[model samples]
Target: MSARPGGWRRRWILLLAFLTPPCRRIVALGSRELDGAAAPWDRWRIRVHRSICTGCRRYLQQLEILREAAHGSTDRPPPTTRLSTESRDRLKRRLRCEPAKS
Candidate 1:
């Protein structure tokens, strides 16, 4: 172990990380926002989390795409709406690569 143990900078980083919600929670918050059921705190958390996490940013984009498709369906005939194989695989890969929660 280093003598400094990362000092104050590292301490702050760890503290911020601890405060930040994990990817799973962020995803849930994003979904809630999409549904207009999110609290103000949730919106702030989602905004902050997405700024640092590419996987979650992509996931939210995918969610938006799905939402728009769902809304469009209400105006017309409803067919099976599904992600394309590539999108599904990409999403899976991103989720898999994310760091696990403590």
Candidate 2:
């Protein structure tokens, strides 16, 4: 078979894709730390990352807010009204009929 143009670029793209996924472990460690299951080293690693990575800092803050909300400590009062079963069913049916969003 003849060599194809851009074949090396395709190989590099596949190599980078595989390599990048290993970094997700750090993000997962950060998540686990927020959830209170982190070891001492994990906490250190996550703290160092949070100190340097603003995105991770924001993510941790969001996790804290969500955890508080899950425990019923929301900053604002929840809606007092409830949707009727018929209304909810209609909404669900409408959603089901809509095309899946990207």
lDDT of 1 by residue, 7-101 (tens): 97666656655777999999988888988999998898788777667899899999989888987976775355666799999999999999999
TM-score of 2: 0.46
The clash numbers for all candidates, in the given order, read 0, 0
lDDT of 2 by residue, 52-82 (tens): 5567668778878888788884546556656
User: Each prediction's TM-score against the native?
Assistant: 0.55, 0.46
